[model samples]
Target chain A: MKKYTNTGSKDTRSGFGAGMTELGQKNENVVALCADLIGSLKFDEFKKNHPERFFQVGIAEANMIGIAAGLTIGGKIPFTGTFANFSTGRVYDQIRQSVAYSDKNVKICASHAGLTLGEDGATHQILEDIGLMKMLPGMTVINTCDYNQTKAATLALADHHGPAYLRFGRPVVPNFTPADEPFVIGKAIMLNEGTDVTIIATGHLVWEALLAAEALEAKGISAEVINIHTIKPLDDTAILKSVAKTGCVVTAEEHNFLGGLGESVARVLALNNPKPQEFVAVNDSFGESGTPEQLMEKYKLNNQAIVEAVERVIKRK
Target chain B: MSNTQQLQDFSTQVRRDILRMVHAVNSGHPGGSLGCTEFFTALYQQLLERKPGFNMDGIGEDLFFLSNGHISPVFYSVLARSGYFPVAELATFRKLNSRLQGHPTTHDGLPGVRMASGSLGQGMSVAIGAAQAKKLNGDKHLIYSLHGDGELQEGQNWEAIMYASAKKIDNLIATIDLNGQQIDGSTDDVLNLGNLKTKFEAFDWDVLEIKEGNNIDAIIKGMTEAKSRTGKGKPVCVLLHTVMGNGVDFMMHTHAWHGKAPNNEQLAVGLAQNAETLGDY
Candidate 1:
């Protein structure tokens, strides 16, 4: 079995902030807009360094999205920052009409996603943003796993010419990925290779998948772990090759079971390999106010849950 | 021909195109299109500082966005007649695989459209963003947008309105087609947008009223004055009071033709009222 180590603990939002600060200095055409959450989105350095490039849109999410779309007209790359819930749900029509349908070069960077948003509860934590964003035609949906991956993804999307949604979380987690690893859109990263079962994880659950691989290896069960950051253009080649070798798969995400990574993987398998698959995702339910650790444990979104799902899927295979 | 006569002739041809295109399809909004025919003609013909050919960036030239996009017939006609696309392509309006979408959209790579704006109350924000980009680039050009009076009911407009004034986006001229009618009924009966001029003034905007919006000379004068008000401290708003379905005696003065197409006989009546001067597509 292969082993992984956490370099440190860091929040993905800070990675975004670091990336934005770098972009402010590097790309003259890059601009940022915040809908009354500049501090929460960690945009202090960018705002201070490039005041002319920042727009404070004051609590209006719809206007922010529209303004971002419009800024793309004269060759300016606009990045909009807000909570995940407000970014996807509140201004869906604005995104649909002005950004997605029009094919504008706007990057919608959403933070505080899923139950890991902690005590702010379901109203603030958004679990359906991935599905909502991926449904738009030509939209690139990316959910990074750690601080290093998030920063790399932010820097990479500046050169990508199209509407994209980059989803991240608020809570700090294990910073395992390498600092200089170049983030590639729509490419899955293979963490460990084994022959028993394939564990495809994304977002916060990626760290848990690594832990599950170690635990499964202790029980004399070999596991293959893969991190799928981009959900829209799913890396079907990697998933099919892993599932073809393992004969079964377990998909994990910090989202609902329906219309998420699980469903996407299920479709790919059902269409190609037809392997036995299990889902480690939230059922049809909303999250409540709880600490980040409490919510992860209560929702069965930990390493133990992934191990159990892998075992169940291996049995089916 | 004089400048006003030339524009009036072009506007008459635009009205003919609107009536014929809607009548051919048997579905479209001709009421607001006819009402704003003169405004469209003047803006595209004489007002806008346009480049020779179509370009999407529009950095050095003026840009216009149609917020109330149901009135696409007039917009499409003027865009085609002004050489954005082939005038003969007006026959493909609302057809499958046509760049002329039911509303103005950039999805099909339409030459003139910058954003999709069938959904109301979004154009002002987009225009402001473009205006801000012009400011950032020191382009010294202006951004223009048109909306319906009824579109102000959407809350997003207020957000954009407040942002434009607060940001001092003076290089934008947002016009409202105050035709006093929507798909439902009169604006007064449905939801009265009380005292729009005063409302705009309270929001710290430079507001002007074009009482004879359907008149070619009046629109030209009003739009010229609106352009003069730019580059100061606030955005400019031109409240154009036009009769719904203007230029056609039968369709005028009512909301009945708001979204309804003209029948064959009705099309003949409308075409008779506005004789073609620049020829039809």
Candidate 2:
């Protein structure tokens, strides 16, 4: 792999923290509710600056979601922070009936998602969160990559009415996307342009996708990498256009392959524009306690597996 | 709407509206709705400091939440007769593409409902949260919530109770509709909610029990006392002892009518028990 740049890396949760701090300064109605994950969710600064707006609900995510829904009645924009498992699975029914179906403007900001959550193990790592949230009718699912984009996404979801699930993670990957990139829901961003095959990824895998593209470039093959941050709305126009041009697709995420972004892309392509596709995601297995790097290798979610998937899909094409 | 006769007439019309709304829908809950009719009517029409029409962001005046939202017939009837929406919309209950569903929701832009509640055990937390918001806004007016006695078993209710008391949520007051019946049978037989008043006292709530929850004067007195008890560094709980079916004779004092709609003939008898003080919808 061509080592383009390795100067800096940042934890995505810091992006959430930074964005929330900005929102607190800019908007008076922006409030934060956390379930004993303020430090982990990178919300210490907001708590200090805006103690009135920040609610430390203390380890009860179900109540936190309920409170967030209530706060919306007074025309307040509430951002709820917790781990992915606690944010969605443990409080699925609360989020389903209270927030999503009730149509409250609540931002369900979840950090430390998937196997990338590392040493905390499978119980804390929610591989099924995306599926659970996406199954709801009025939920906007977004998995932001790196520091800048995650921060931008957090700020953007603040202004968006209705329930939204903004997911980020623990790993500190490359911060490559433009720092000032305006976050847009239901849209995909193309990082690199090519014609051989398209590499679509989200969350921490976007950096891996860019690396895979550069590697394929050295091998006399041009790879187009598209970062798909929003999974529910499944940017059908971008996916169809990119696949039609490249003739093959490789989707990557730090999530289960069953109902993650790959499956969403597959469903769209399978119907309108059928193409060869490869998925770089965790198979049907729970995670064990390990470093984030070891878990990535064990789960087959590294750049090497993605590069191989791209080669396989290209051959099929 | 000016005279005492009109206010009494309004309450009677609300009771009639509740009967017809549930019967027309054929899939609505009328037990809790009928049980707490006078209490709700007094709260909206006489007790609460509210404007004629409801606003989403209700300011200055007090707010109420139906944690036990299965009683939507009563809630909607009170809200409509209180002039929140057109009374004709009550007939659209449970129909496809209708604003009124089996469970109460705010999805149809229903003016009165703040949040959806079909899944039980969440309304208390929401009500407590609204109270918290009232405190945040520095709105001295209190918040009101009505929960089912059988719903006390939900761990979330305990959490809300514990949280409100621990934090001294003084600006909030909640009521438990102590009807003592679940869908299956008696509340004693279903889950045995042993002693709710003692339970609230142990949880550090200022508990007040109403002997006749269906009586308008008692409801008015109990609700006013509950409101006055707030702003004193403790949340108030009024354990209302209400009959499962209060006004209608044949439907009263039985768990069978907890979820069943009255048959056409039964509906006539039930309607006859309560006079149509305000014209029927």
Candidate 3:
């Protein structure tokens, strides 16, 4: 079994802020727009450094999206920052018409996604953003797990041509991935090698999946852990190869069971290889106000949930 | 021929094309298209400082965006006649695999289209952004956009309007096609956009009005003056007062023809009213 260590705890939004600050220095064409969430989105440094390149759109998500799309006409790569709910659901039509349908090069960087948004509840925590963004043609969807990965993904998305959605969270989590790791779009990173069962995880759930594998190893069951950062253009080959080695799979994510990473993985499995699969996701219900730890524990999105899912799926296999 | 006569001939031909193109598919918005024919023809022919060819990044040339894209007939005609595409391709309007979509979109690699706009209240922000981009790039070119009067009912327009003035984006000129009609009924009956001149002025924008938007001479004069107002630390808004359906008598002054296509008999009548100055595509 391979062991992973947490370097320190840092919020993923900080990684985004760090990445954006670097982009401002490196790329002159990189412009940033925020809909009155500069402090929440952690864009203080970038805005301070690149005042000319930054636009503070006041509480207008739709207008912000439209402006980002238009900036592309004159060869400007725009990154729009906001909460996931306002970033996806609130301005879906604007994104669809101007950015996705027109194929504008805009990076929709969303923070505070899923139940982990904490205390803000269902209205602010958006679990269906991945599904909404992935459904748009030519849209690349990436949900990075930790601080290092989120920062790398932000820098990587600046080079991508079409519209992209980069999702992160508000809570501080384990900074596990390498600080200088090259983030690859649509490519899965293998965390551990095992044959007993495969645990595929994304976003904040990825760190939990690693811990779950260690627990499963203690129980004399070898669990393979794979971190899927990019939800759209899903690495089917990696998923299939892992599933082929281990007949059953446990898919985990901090999102709704209906339209998140689990369903995407299920579609791939059902199309290619029909196998025993168990989903560790929020079962089609809205979230309530609570701390990040309480919500993750209550929603069964912790390492224990993955362990139970692995046990149940192993029996089915 | 004189510039005004040449532009008038082009406007007549564009009106002819708008009527025929919408009639061919038995679907499209011809009322506003007809209403804005003169504005489109005049802008493309005499108003803009445009390059010869089309490119996605219009860095050095004046850019035009159609915010009220349902009236794509006039826009498509003017773009084709201005050498953006083949005039013969006007037959493909609203057809599958055609670059000329029902509403203008850049999805099909349409040359003149920079962004897709069918849903209302989005074009203003895009134009403002492009104008800002021009400033950022040190490219001294203006951005122009057209919108329907009723589209102002959408709240997003006000947001963009407020942002434009606060940011002091002086390189954009957004025109409103004040035809006084929407899909359902008159703008007064539908939403009542109370005193657009006052509203724009209150928003700290430089406001101008053209009482005769259907007249090519009036549009030319209004747009030329609007052009002079640019680079003066305020975004300009031109409120163009036009009849709903300008040239075609039966369709004029009514919202009934907003999105409905003219029948075979109505098409002939409409075409007869617009003289074939440069010949139809």
Best by lDDT: 3
lDDT of 3 by residue, A1-317 (tens): 89788999999999999999999999999999999999988899989999999999999999999999989988999999999999999999999998999899999999999999999899998888888999999999999999999999999999989999999999999999989889999999999999999999999999999999999999999999999999998999999999999999999998888888999999999999989999999988889999999999999999999999999999999
TM-score of every prediction relative to native: 0.99, 0.96, 0.99
Q: Can you rank all candidates by lDDT, best first? A: 3, 1, 2
| Model 1 regions more than 4 Å off | none
Clashes per candidate (backbone, < 3 Å): 0, 0, 0
Identify the runs in model 3 with alpha carbons over 4 angstroms from their true place. Answer: none
Error of 2 at A107 (Å): 0.6
B88: Cα error in model 3, Å: 0.8
lDDT of 1 at A228: 99
Candidate 3: count the clashes: 0
lDDT of 3 at A172: 96
In order, the interface RMSDs are: 0.6, 1.2, 0.7
Q: Write the per-residue lDDT of candidate 2 for residues B1-281, one digit (tens) a residue.
A: 24446666776777788789888867688888889887788888887778556676576778888888788888988888888888888888778898887788988888888889978888877776777777678778777888988878777777778878887888777889988888999889989998888988899999998888987778778888888888888989999999988888877887777788887998899888888877777
- Model 1 - which docking category? high
**Who is ahead in TM-score, 2 or 3?**
3
Each prediction's whole-model lDDT (CA): 0.93, 0.86, 0.93
Query: DockQ, per-model, please?
Result: 0.85, 0.66, 0.85
